[model samples]
Target chain A: MDSITPNEIDIVRASSSKINEIDFENLAFGNIFTDHMLMCDFRDGKWQKPTIKPYEPFLLDPSAKVFHYGQAIFEGMKAYKDESDDVWLFRPDENFRRFNASAKRMAMPEVPEDIFLGGLHEILKIEKEWVRKGKGNTLYIRPFMIAIGTGVIAAPSTQYRFMIILSPAKSYYSGEVKVIIAEHFSRAANGGIGAAKAAGNYSAQFYPTKLANDKGFQQIIWTDDATHTKLEEAGTMNVFFRINDTLFTAPTSERILDGVTRKSIISLAEREGIDIQVRSVLVAELVEAAKNGSLKEIFGAGTAAVVNPIVGFSYQDEYFELPKIENSVALKLKDKLTNIQYKLEEDTFGWTVKI
Target chain B: MDSITPNEIDIVRASSSKINEIDFENLAFGNIFTDHMLMCDFRDGKWQKPTIKPYEPFLLDPSAKVFHYGQAIFEGMKAYKDESDDVWLFRPDENFRRFNASAKRMAMPEVPEDIFLGGLHEILKIEKEWVRKGKGNTLYIRPFMIAIGTGVIAAPSTQYRFMIILSPAKSYYSGEVKVIIAEHFSRAANGGIGAAKAAGNYSAQFYPTKLANDKGFQQIIWTDDATHTKLEEAGTMNVFFRINDTLFTAPTSERILDGVTRKSIISLAEREGIDIQVRSVLVAELVEAAKNGSLKEIFGAGTAAVVNPIVGFSYQDEYFELPKIENSVALKLKDKLTNIQYKLEEDTFGWTVKI
Candidate 1:
């Protein structure tokens, strides 16, 4: 494990290709992968030289801290291809910054920007062919860190593994979604790991979200843990509400993720001179707005789906069906973000990086 | 990938033993593992054959769900050796029941009893020599489950791996522990994964616990998430207070783990005719009792350290030192539990299982 300087990266090319076996027409979101992956190790007080090798299973000691204690964090982003086969990344710097923030909260070492962004640059260059050219098709990039130390003393790990894997994906969800406002179960507490892209944050919602699914809901709109009166976020996504013409979303705090897509939409809305409010959104007010037909549209903002529209929402015994509008904020924001990502529109905000 | 029946266990003995290389005199808690481990995999909607294989590194896909989503749960127990060379387990059934309960909360498949307990029975038989005969020396058993599916999806993994590993451990802590009442950080919410032995629960404390450690405290006495008013659990342990001659502890709720050692201590205190109270313990009242000299003893109960005595506590810029007392409840309970565990006391409660 030689120490890696800022700009050096070791590469090992695969002997053969597995890309021909993949079916891009009916691709699952995170299933199929590219040929190569990127990896770096934090061992003996410094990050070792990063390497791009053929994507394969690696052997780990059974007592690795990651299997016993959840000291893991991940970042999700996507690369889109234009008609000319040019690759573009939508705001990879935000994901990079948030990845380190997640590491700091988990008591793990942060990867340097050179190692993170530089390694991604090298791997994406090699695997750019995996980025399919279409409206919703993409090469989903997952950069993650795990505690790979070989002891299990209920403490932070000394050794860490940071890796990037690429998987081709189609749109996450096909149609409009229905969600239930969480009343009993809480996704995260005030001083917990809700805001970070911590691994445990997603797993904690699976059970409660399963209950909502059983009751005919596709997702859950989680509320604040203290009183469950203020809406916070949806499962794996940040939520936004459009009341009449004003756009409202919960402010980012220790309790809510400062999502990349949510901020992008806020910026785009500001550019469009639309009324935007970032504050505590009360469930009572949202319900009242729904009753008075002021709640025009509801959608989720995330890296996976860009924007997912919600057709209806259920609260306790009453279900509110959101009125369909000719011009939806979700559709407008999704189209703008996608156009920038696919290189169809000018990158005025410099949100997309070309490779 | 063959299906294993209830009574069938495939065994693959280690080619060579690493036991000679290990130093029993200076063994860390979970560092030195035995020669063999038990494993069973859930694949394609059914659990495969259980196997007791030589302990080795496992090859996992880079996209394994456990690394990305933290779909993992674990249990801790111990095995003791008597003078006659008979090995004993203290309430293995309790750990088995709790493991499945944890699995349920994580939306994972419940491991069959035969796979869990039977695997433990076989592993103990093969590595009985790891159970050292001493007052504190014992074989610490770690049973854990992890999501092993080859995908980067945020949803729960369909494939699972259940494993048991053994490590020789002495007493966990060496001195009297010091803890601070948490004022800002909360561990779990009213409807979160606090009660489950989920992997994330331990890692979540590392950051905040490090804050207490910096302030010279060894652990933290967490309060309720709603207001941080009532006492909850101490760092990974159930807390107890001895006010005057009565014992008090927080009642088990969704926010607190139902610790096995806690219940055992309650039963042992009942048998000794000591007054025991299980209810909400307010932090204000606890502070007042300490100030007035009614708080004689504060201890933590768990599987790692049967009972860990606390010397003092800090709250809101004020540190209170507890006067040491003769006939301390922590010492009494520790002696009682270890005696029962090592076959030095009567087996009146039917707690130990001899193998």
Candidate 2:
């Protein structure tokens, strides 16, 4: 039934390189792209030949539905280069599955597993130089699908373009990371597109996050909409709380992204025999824990920042700071995750997918 | 800071004409486009001179954040041409206000009322012929804002572009609608981006709406996330249910859009001395009403399809059909609203904005 042989793809080297133009050190999270990108079109009811070409603009009509209706979905994962110059992906299969999950929510065509994995391999392999060799340095791969049909219908676009662009990056957030727990705003709702990494989810967050930034917090911890008591996620990153000797994180809900890192950390925590709870952590309970000296550390977990320690958080006009300790779980988890990513630690769980 | 003089505005009409290329009779919702478009850049922290230019492709860098992070917001409203050749907008001011509200949520810049109104006026005035004259026909104007700065920072974009594009003619949804009352799905969440017509909100909906479509329902009536028992809205339209001759519509919340037509319908119902309830209507209550013959009608209100009555609805595998009435509020309100829109009736509420 497969007309085109599996693993068949076209390759074209970039005529020129933007590698010289992008400053590796000053690179922001997702902005500066590498020399080449992977692109494929879904037409005639199937994905066409995947192609790797120079990262440049396409001749898309302005009336493309994606620009108008937001018929777009994207995935965020990184490719790390270890000491031996070998590149690795921390369970890109999970990202592929999550990407399809997002696509299903947005009514986009689900990319075949082979196509998604092939696209990623094709992109990272060609732009291997974009993978920076150092701690907190990696090639951020942005795999996105956009509705490019030249029409403005308030419906789903029939045609789509799936592309994977690589960017050399450092930590998304620099310096001390602080956040506010949102009780007044929601990123998404149950029975809504909250679980999908559709483009609008991040855009929906910019305002509230900006307000938090204005209040001296680097990010926001979105709480459940009904009562605003149960912590959902950091929206972009899954959140973990360290209370005394035990660690707790909110279980995945329809409203929170089932983050790749969030799940991995759960496995890692179990391997190390640390006490952990995957349940709703009420904000009131967390505040009480902070006041009772039971809160040891609170950090965000995600692909961008493996473990971002939260310095302080404001909730209901009350500010609370978690006590810092020399023996902190955030520091230890960060080391373990990074070591697995950089190939310094044993891949006990086989989480590392070598490209 | 009033700067733009209409006489000095740079105007360049689209050289290519796609209007003739389109089949008006067979037109599908937002798929076709007209010739000209309006654009004004936000640079140096101020809106630049607005330009009416040819509708064409945009020269965007590959790293434009809108493609990845979904940094965009938009407003949907229509311009109606009366039999006497007068073009009117139904409460365009409400659209402008809501647009900014969405802008605030997405962290896009607020478009000044004057600029937004002035731009639409200019565009509509120039493309007057494209504003179809037939009943139930109009020019759909899409006013949108997109983050333009090509930086990959996972933060708010520094630069933005406010644009107005025109799509000629036809209703979005065809025929009498059948809806499914949501029990497990939600449109927006409390303190979430539900109230805003942000682009992401729409993208997030495509997949869920598809599920409803597959279930043989044309659209869905989204319910509150807290319990998923109370009815909120249709996919794109505000919902209204009639029980024992009393009109009831859910109050706009942080999770519901303050629809322009919705407010108009409320006022029209009140002015006509019709009993109305602006409160939550539980889904079970409506389903029970359907069982007991207390439910009269279910209608959806929005810009595209003024007031669409749901012929039937299904919940928990039980289907209920709304009996066709001699003069349903859905039909009456639709006529009244369209009359005011087409300048056939008195603009008692002053919703008509003459172009």
Candidate 3:
């Protein structure tokens, strides 16, 4: 194994597959897993040869750094099966690049392109049946890294593990999501770790999200740290707002994540000649637009939900409801993106890669 | 086991101790572990009875939530053995209370007081030899909680593991420290998990601290997230300043941790009839005082260091050196706290608890 280059991946197949036991029609988003997974270890100054092994539990020391210091990062993507039983991935290179970027911000080691992309390609080919063929059914691909150093110190770990897990996912949200604009809580500060897809970033929102859930909202539109007046994101997704026919969204900054789905939507809208404005959106301006009926639509973009439409939002004890429309921007964009993902349309953008 | 109440702890002794192989004189701060550890599980909507067992590896699923979402929290404390072979702890109640407070912030179930205190008492008595005698030698105690649910969804875990591990420590810092005032990076935000001892809060500071280290600074003095003017904290410790015989420190807030050592020093200063000002220490005012020769001293307070004196600070590329004093306030406070911890002097506040 030490003699092998990073691209020369080793394979270890599981004795059997659990596919027959899984009920695809009644599947939860992330509860079911495929037979095989990809793993690589960072040791002796570099990443070793990648390996595809059986998915199993690890016998780790209780003092592993990830259990104490939270030096962990992850990426989310999806694998879809086309009508012709061909497997395709949407913009996997973007996720590959972003994963290394996240590792750098957390002071962790970067995974080489050969290892990350090559391992992902090989694993998807082995577990191709996991990718269900349907409009909304797909295999959710999770690429994650963790600090595995067996020392109970508050510092960067010298050892790490990078692994990829696949789960069958249905549509993330069943209906239009309702959100509340954060008035006091903040997600990340300027020059903070908010831009990285760190594990801690997601857990920090659970308590505040529960608060919003109790008040009848499914998510929160995080605002600026200095003043909760400018909307930044909506619970792990990048937010976009429409006033009349113009679209407005907060630009990627040190305080907001640069999502792959968000950038794809921007490119799609620009090609379609849609008026898109990527700038800081003030909460007051959004509320005013909603009151005056110019706020035509709101939606979020992410891997879990390619396009999640927002039906209403609450701010400062006042709720503003968005009217339902036929052929809305969100509906149109979701359809277009899904069609491209499933290879239903021509590969004009060349975004899909077949395994 | 299911019938046992939360207060009834079960003890499982180690087959043998590793005391003979240890070098107490050359111990690192958090590397050497004791023979036994305390662990408890949280399931079925409540904390199970605590158990003491040999320290060893844990068999965990690859998808434990703590490794992916970072739902983890911890507390730091110490145990000292007096010259008479009796062990004592300083204000363990404070740590117990704060641990649960952190749990609530991260949406984790709280560890009952009975379980926390009861387990500590039992484990300390069982591993009494690990607590070394004499000053500057002690047992560092780490009590931590982690989400153990084996799922890939971004939600709070239904299963949790709360454990306590002890390590032999020989002081944290050696010399008078040098620090740099943070101007670009923020430790946390107003509505963030900074106040809680969340694992992510500590890991987020590692990259920034490395930058300061590259510039020959031992630590960083973080400032307000909105405006880098008011001082918040220094590394893992709360900072204090003295100018013309008057002491000043920042008041605790949502962005600053409510440190046990910080509050203890404040009480000690008040009892000693020192003029202490608990308010925001602006950067402009501090710089002005340093230039006018009124800035007497600077130091940091925390459980690990007790009191660490600072010799200099750099801000905006300019350095400010503090004067060395024969009887500095930092020195006095450190002596008082350590004396009480080791049972060498009268614990006037009844802070020392015998094990």
Candidate 4:
């Protein structure tokens, strides 16, 4: 929203640009990075001066706490280029707030707003050209913090590292998505770090997701850990269900992430006078709806995909294929949300911030 | 159990040893490492050559999956120096098996027995001097694996690194240990990564443990995530409760770790004709026992600390101080286990492996 104070961060220019050697149109999500990245360290109970230098590898001790104890958290956001080549970010304050919440939950120090938002603005200003001007083109922003202190003891780290690395992307998923409702494996506990964007939360889903992949499914719809009956999340994103034109999504809790796109869709749907209900959707109710031909659609909402529509889902060894319909609510909400993000529509909700 | 094939491992000796400048008697657990470390890489769908090089920091990309997704697992073991200058490992095969089980749960490659055990033997041979000869002295073995691939995507990495670092230690805990029974926070979830030694499971407890530390409690006795009615674990170890003369511990399940020391203690107690029961212990029953003077002792069992006795416990604003007794079942079991480990007593169970 505002210019970054030059004194707050040290800048080291890259000797050469790698932009000319790359094909931006065929880029893979989170694969290709910009020429520069942001980094800051925390030691002796305070954060050091920030730095923006050439993107490269760094050294760490073998006993860094992140390797042994998994004290790491991350936030995912995206930068958009408008028609006049002006860059914008969608609800960056939300990501910044959630980042510190994750830090506190993981027992790491909270990052100041100046370092989180100011560093983001400064880095995006330096890497503006990487944000291509197109409807689908975006520069994925990954702001993460990790425990860098060295010790094999099972305790919180005294030192940490905060970094911002940008990757150019097209889209995250490209397929007819099929998911499995988890009946055994779970992603979070009753009072766990599931609400936080902790790195551990993602890896916990990998094995289960791989199992679903082997069965021709792309992801999983995680249910309640104690009683695999209530739906919670879809893969790494917040999930939603549409039955009889009434949309239902689980409210955020200790076992569910508060996704940015998920909240925005709820707000937009309410604004457009759509029947959106926020409550726990039961597996039994979903099966009954599918059997009675009341289930219309299922989708996942997060920053990565914005809204990922599911073609079908499997529960208790029975696969239910969703009916093909026109004017899908998921695509409609995605269109409205992306229009505001790309500066193609009026910003009635005031969610986007100019970089 | 057997000598490693010389060709199977590449040894790079450290130019100098740091042993001359240290105080081993006052050593803090897992703070300092030995002169050499073992490393192996998995890429192209298989583990590469194993190497034992000087202990040092290594380079990694800022976007390494281990830093972003927490795709990591580890094991804890120890090497004991007997009276005749011989090193022996207690149930190393158990640690190796558990390590691979953790790997599979986290979607990482399973290390072959030769590399996991053979590489350990080779490294121990090189750093045998680090294993101090005393009843309390030990060379702590920390074998871990982490995702090394560079990407911000939420998926399993194709590349991984397995490493073994040795830390000489005297003991893991000191002073009286007071525990707080978990009423809100939980360590693991049902059908989750609780059974695996995944790094995430440890960090999740740091925040709650800090809260306990602030209240003058040294550790927390975690309960089941579903209801918080059943006792599960203590800090990072398996917990045990001695009511009257009967010992009880929760059985290994999807939500509890199958600890090596825990099993050893059970076996040792059974051999001594002590009443041992592997079943879930409820909080209400424990409180009732405390009121009736039947709860004799409560302790933790793990690789780092063979047995850690609790001085007192607090639950729901009420504290119960255990009565001091001369014949502690915990100490007796610990003495017997360590005696077998140090070759002071006969190894009737065939649990020790010569290095």
Measured by DockQ, the strongest candidate is 4
Q: DockQ of candidate 2? A: 0.67
lDDT of 4 by residue, B205-264 (tens): 999999999999999999999999999988578999999999999999988899999999
- How much does candidate 1 score in TM-score? 0.97
Question: Candidate 2 docking: what grade?
Answer: medium
Give the residue spans of candidate 3 off by over 4 A: A1-7, B1-7
List, residue by residue over A1-355, the lDDT tens digit for candidate 3. 0223434888888998999999998877677789988889998889987898999888777788888889999999999999999999999999999999999989999998877887888888899999989898999999999998877767888999999999998977676689999988888977789999899998899899989989999899999978898999985689999999998989998889999889989888887788999999999999999999899999999999789999999998899999887768877887888889999988689999888
**Evaluation by DockQ, superior candidate among 1 and 4:** 4
The CA lDDT of each predicted structure is 0.89, 0.82, 0.88, 0.93
Q: How close to the true structure is residue A214 of candidate 1, measured as C-alpha lDDT?
A: 90
Q: How many residue pairs clash in each candidate?
A: 0, 9, 0, 0
User: Candidate 3 lDDT, tens digit per residue, B1-355?
Assistant: 0223434778888999998899999976688789999999999998887899999988878788998899999999999999999999889989988999899999999987767877888888899999989999999999999999877878889999999999989878776689999899988888988888998887888889888889888899999988999998985899999988999999988789999999999999998888999999999988999999999989999998789999999999999998877789889988888988999988999888898
DockQ values per model: 0.78, 0.67, 0.78, 0.89
DockQ for candidate 1, please give it.
Answer: 0.78
What's the CA RMSD for each of the models? 2.4, 2.5, 2.3, 0.9
Candidate 1 regions with alpha-carbon error over 4 angstroms: A1-7, B1-7
Order of models, best DockQ first = 4, 1, 3, 2
Question: Which pairs of residues clash in candidate 2, taking residues 3 or more apart in a chain or in different chains?
Answer: A30-B152, A31-B152, A152-B30, A152-B31, A153-B30, A153-B31, A186-B191, A191-B185, A191-B186
- Model 4: lDDT of residue B40: 97
